[model samples]
Target: MARKISAPSLFQLGYYWEAKIFLTSVKLDLYTPLAKGPKTAKNLAGLIEADTDALTRLLDALVSIGLLRREGDAYANIPELAEFLAKTSRFYMGELMLLQDAEWDHWGKLEDIIKTGKPTVQDNIFMNTPELGATVSKVLHRMAKRVAPALAEKIDLSDYKTLIDVGGGGGAFTIAFCQRYPHIKASLFDLPQTLKVAQENIAQAQLNHRIELIEGNFNTGPLPGTYDVVFASDILHYQTEAENAALVKRLYDATEPGGFIIIKDMFIDDDENEPGWNAVFSIHMMVYSEKGRCFQGKKIRDWMTQAGFDNIVEIEKNTILAGTKGV
Candidate 1:
């Protein structure tokens, strides 16, 4: 008989063992079967090509982990996991799992990384080659495209004529916005190699006519002052606190008076203990970046105030931070 394992010690390890199981299920496309409706054990086994007995246990394990729900003789996808984990869902977060999987290999080297304080990206299989990075960037763009349009609804973006996506990987955000607001022209700022994928995504979205592509590192170069709204999503976590302040200042200068700067990223709670997701992401950043991690909204508000942006507002809880430059 196999000895039963206990829940991972929260203080000893940052990640729970169940996270590993969930990600494995995601990789195997196990969530897709239940996206449409619940499935019987035999049906799910056929879909996954696994033994029915093993598959039943697998489904039960998933349910225990809160990613799936089993009612009587039927098993169904949990709504949150169904929407985000299933590849068929529009808001699918499979790419986020890809990102996580890329980092998973490096978890073995966590001790070394902790002692050396260096990124394991190059050594890991997921980020070793430029081509792989580009591929991951494209996947990330698809994820962003799914997320941005939903945000456009509540915000008043009518006055803005141009949207500049800074470090905009894959240009999905720009594609979504341009498609929704036909009058708004879009510009994507990224390295040439990365922008190539963005160009392809734009063509896929059929927004090529309304978008312009610019190639350069925004960190080393001065931001051009023509855009009405400057946006950064899931990019700033790569920079240090001082770099974030400088970048915000640059965006403040680049925007015309009355224009807005929008930042979309995971925000830590004020006390830094809430939002378990944000806290876990901070650990992930420690593995990927030397100095960056999930930032607090208070810090973002302070950055806006210091950068001369007025009317700073936390845009709901979508991890969006927005502020307008003085008119």
Candidate 2:
């Protein structure tokens, strides 16, 4: 059923108090110390060099939100969340939250942007700050460990011999694709700085020979070479519709006949109200990017069709699409 609402619920929706508190905890690395053992607010404050009373209030608030547990005066990190929140854990996802914490100030310009039809930032994170962008990409890679492998399961790449991962930050998708399809050679393409980080990842995966690192911006020129599969994952949302369409068209051009082009991105419903995540993400894009916005699926499919792709299918609803370049 569609989300039902009441007056109180509507009011609750406006509250971002819990979100900010949670983000604050992640930013402060509070969970790391708590992971060692339960600690009093004073102990935590002394370690972090913050006021004891204020840290107590914040810790109590975290208890209220179920992220921490309190017994008397000591607070403990929730066992399950510690896997993701503890700095020593292999699965720590603090970096992604740090990125959000960094961008919190840009959201302050939302009202002014809405009124003036302008953005707070000149470019998206990837283009404006490559170092931070590379780190954030690695964080996302760890957070969604199954994303690319799952995509590999969905798409049939058995016959394809080569692939190009456009804007392939950290080479996550390329790594997954090559791992799943051993016969295929892959190219991971992105800015030079991002490729350096990807190089380290590829080496760690021991796939340096199977995956080639190609350094170039996809937006500045045509992709370096044609391939059996041109896969641009999680990249289109950072551009205007015109740029997205043009990129899709280029993907079609680079795709060899009898092969495919795939774009994986958040596509909002035409009514612009459901899949609540993408809807709100569109607003985030508008505030943080000069032209980025979540787009409608059919609009992008139409561009693919216009570019002469045949047998197009939406492999996942409003998320991924695969189009064939007819022989």
Please, what are the lDDT tens digits per residue for candidate 1 over residues 262-287? 88888877764455467677777777
**Model 2 C-alpha lDDT per residue in residues 5-94, reported as the tens digit of each score:** 999998777897888999999988999998899999999999899999898899989999999999777999888999999998998889
Task: Candidate 2: count the clashes.
Answer: 0
Worst 10 residues of 2 by lDDT: 269-278
lDDT of 2: 0.86
Quote each prediction's TM-score. 0.72, 0.96
Query: Global lDDT of each model?
Result: 0.78, 0.86
Clash-forming residue pairs, model 1: none
